[model samples]
Target chain A: MTRKREFTNWIFGRELRDSRELEERPDEERAKPYVITPLGTRVRRVLFCGLVSQKNADESMTRVTVTDGTGNFYISAFNSDFGMQAKAMVDALEINDQVLVMGRVSSYQNEGKTYFNVNPEIAIKVDSVSMDYWRMKTLHIARRKIYAIRMARNRPGSTATDVKAAGYSDLEAESAMKAMEKYPDYDLQEFESAIAAQIQPAAKEEHKSSKDFILQYIQANDTDGRGCRYEDLLAASQNASISQNELDDLLNSLGSDGEIFEVSLKRYKVI
Target chain B: MSDQVKRLKISELVPGTQNVDILVSIVSLQRKELKNERGESVYYYGILGDDTGTISFTAWIFPPTVRIGDVVEIKKASVREYKGINRVYIDAGSEVIMHPGESMDVRRSYSQLKIKDLSTAQPYVTVEGRVSSVREKELERDGKKTMMYYGDLDDDTGKIRISSFDKPLKEGSFIRMEGAKVSEYNGRLRMTLGSRTEVTEIKPSFQVGERLYDIHDISSPLGGVTVNGFIVSLGPKSGLVMRCSACNNRLDDIHCPDHPEAPVAYDLFAYFTLDDGTGSIQCTGGKAALLGHLGFTPEEYTPENKTISRRLVSSRLQEKLLGRAVVIEGDVTRNQSGTSVRISSLNYVDTDFMKKLEARMGADFQ
Candidate 1:
């Protein structure tokens, strides 16, 4: 099963109890059953409901500490190891806010103290429940309109406001706007597709040229000892004669070819 | 001409040659300093030597990544006279290649020889000398401790001090020397050793006394002389002291009480005045270390007793040694204050040499 699906299933079946009842149990007793339980014992997969206590960034790792009143544990993401998923986790966190972390439990010993560590497979902002559910359902239709407008703006000579005037709603337009902020070197169509893939995974097949164009540009300019710069490629596209849809298709194709690598957000270089 | 001409060992290369290429084993390495006509510091050079001979090479274009024992092929290099001494300089436009593991036929160079044969060389001979005076000097260049030392030795016939190393030799106590291209210092002749000078104490039959000699008297053809004199005054005028601001305890910088952001002060002025009847002058800094070897401590002149003022001590000591007859050997420097002489090794003169001098002077002395 997919990791996300497993996490959702665990959350649906876990035995829920009041937070106070869990806290009253002695620490030794609480951890004993979890450790000695044979692997054959139906493994208990559960979702932890907790308040975000701390967030730390060190080099390439981001660790978030969460306290569920009964205990506190850490959720670590090595951004170098899991790029997009790690970034998504960092973007969704807010200190003191409540969150639902779904993962497997493992014990760790550090400085002679034993603590439980959670390798979270899924995380969601608890406050966005009812509102976020409806938003996800209607998101696809709205995103398509936004994608069309972004593609239009990305045309060689088109202005950004020209896409807004073509009838994209403010929030839909703002989603593309925020994606541009995250990927400054991305052309409007590439930005739209990257965000679209996150919100609607099937949309990846819909836009392929944006990735191919980036790959071709990186290969052409990477001959000099120095690697190609992302901004230079984006600027080149602005001056190229290609249509927006064709450019989008090119970038996606290049990503699959592995001729170019994303060194940083919006920063692409020849591998 | 045959394209496969036999390669010449570095020692076999004639002193005067243009575009000579040779493969040689590095016998020693010594660091060197040179200034351009504009007084701008240009290169920190080194000397590389083989059993055949030694050559001076400049490290201006690249940092020296080569060590003392690496064998390298010097291609299209040239030999030239630097300040009247024969030395080798690599051509700037030439390509110098280094081979990490290639072996070449070995031949001992002149600088690699012992004091026995060094004495027979007619007039000018290149030889390695042991360090007799190493003083750490703090200057305002890179805010680092620079060490300057005078090495003294007898090439069997004479002794001289080779000025070397702006950085302290913080490693082995014994310094190995090589590639000392002979030159003149003041009116007396001396030699300047380079970085490629080999410093090792593993040779058989090595005796410190056999090689020790007075740098000044070496050129005079005078054999052995010793001097005994009283210390009139002593301290380092250009000496260094590091003190912690918090507790005022003397520190080694690493353990300052204030630490990290603590303020530590470095004082660089101390001197000592000594007299041996014939002459006396101020000795400062590492020169003062010699006094400690003779039995004196920094606490002797502390302010509590106030027996001697710092300035008075220096001056009185200087005057007391003004005309005392004493035997001493080492390097001497003439500075603005007076003539500063560092005594590398000393002993009292016996009555023999004195009686000989008295007999030569005849009845006029009586």
Candidate 2:
């Protein structure tokens, strides 16, 4: 079999319409007729076909980003919807995978750059990217989008219905609901800034110091050698610029990752 | 058997009688104090009088459970001295018997007595007079409800104050009074209407026109005057001893057997140092029993004589006395210390003036 035939089989079916044949037809008669503008505006309905760009997974959420030549957008899936069915879809998306994204076109302006956004209400990956990569990337984009909406709607006066209607995950909707109750005048921008300022730095530093500390502490003394107490760890981390809450988060991450085990209440030991 | 002294009238007897056996009608009986076994106390004393004279008496053993106006025969009662004044005392050893056969008509005792003739007798006598004024006051004394009605009465000879307890007599009404003891207060002869003093209003035979007076009207001209003032301070030394708690007898000493180191019960009294700011007087009397009846415990402000000094009398008593005009008939004497005037017999002027004042003051008086 010829490579062209293989490519054709991979893309479509046995009988395919040629590009010239589509060009020979009138604009209204074209199979996929759309316009892309440089100013982040698409005049006609456009099809975004690409492999998964990135994937990120956390305990609470998963996120995925998809990109074609024109622009890129994200989708998020929360733990509440991270069932086997959603996981299966997440498993299928991969980096560099060829996918067909069909959704409504939406736009957002940030930092003076207008970004064309498509909410991929539907997605189909092709043979170019692995199923695993696609799944992870979809999950990653879904989590990011979920987190963004959650952070946004946590501002004062934002309601759950508003967040949900803006296409946020259920977990995001729930968090926004609770935050709205607490600070009814919360500003969405302020909340997003706070989360960014809080989470980003810790997430960066935690990977290095926390992992090294756990490994060294476990190696020098057997799991119980010094009896890892939360208070003791807190004391050790006191000199750091990080806040108590951030340090606690790192410790939690370590515990969940099985690098340490909580031998007693608030006391940790190496796993 | 000295021929029973020829059935002597109380008027014929000496001013002080010792070991005198006499038959006399009890004009009034009041609760007084005596000591009991275990050195506790008891109440068995009161004023007993007849048509001729009246004296305070004490029953040493059993209390005489008798009412006012009862005729009683004292077989061998002896006179004793109290505070330099002589009083009669009867005991179980004395043949003190209540005689129903010798009943005396209470009203007839005052039937012939006129308000003007009362001054001639050495001993105080009752007189029927018309109430020219009546004043009713609602008061709370030591947490107990007490209403005092003070009024002036005139029998065309002179005017005297008629004070009713807990009730107000109608103004312009005539009332017959009996067993009212007389004393001098604030330089004026005053009569005290005790618990047994009977007061009943009757239709006046002649109407007395309304008389107008102010606080300044309480001069020497109104021989018996009624005035009111707020009680500023009270003291305990104003009256006699009180009954002991355990014994219920008047305690003469500071200590009692049950409470050997301290007196169990104390006779409390109030000396109202009152002022309208224009003038002031001090009214001292046995106030403990009255205060106790009104629900107050004696509080000692100073240690001397266990006296309650400079105390604020209850608001009810204050309201009853303060800012009102009263009529007092007795000798008005300047206190020996020359600090204030003392009116021994003080009563409210009456309700007629009070009603007019109330009308002028509008609802604020209420």
- Best-fitting candidate, scored by lDDT: 2
Q: How much is the lDDT of residue B290 in candidate 2?
A: 46
DockQ of each: 0.00, 0.00
Write model 1 residue lDDT over A8-75, tens digit each, in one string. Answer: 11111101110101112255465422321100111223444455767777667667766432224467
Compose the digit string of candidate 2's lDDT tens values, residues B1-366: 232423444544443454567777675555545455667555456556665656656676543467777788776666667643346677766767778757863332332354434431223356677876678888898999988887777764446666667646777778767756555455444555667677777665543433322222233323333444323344434443455666766666656657666545555444555432223455554552245433445464223434342233444344343333344333233333432333445544444544453353233213
Deviation of model 2 at B8, angstroms: 4.6
Please identify model 1 stretches exceeding 4 Å from their true place.
A1-271, B1-7, B24-33, B39-75, B80-86, B97-319, B323-325, B329-353, B356-366
Across B293-337, the per-residue lDDT of candidate 1 in tens digits comes to 323356653434356344554444333232222345544444334
Candidate 2 residues A1-271, lDDT tens each? Answer: 2121000001100001101111111554533332222111112222333436567767655566654311234555444643443444544676555554434333444565443433333345543222212222222322333354445544656666766667654444654454344433434443233223212344335436655644443332232344554543443343234456877787778878888777767767776
Q: What is the TM-score of chain B alone in each candidate?
A: 0.41, 0.34
Cα lDDT, model 1, residue B184: 38
Tell me what fraction of the real C-alpha contacts between chains A and B each candidate also makes. 0.00, 0.00
- The candidate that achieves the highest TM-score relative to the unseen native structure: 1
Lowest summed lDDT across 10 adjacent residues in model 1 chain B is found at: B214-223
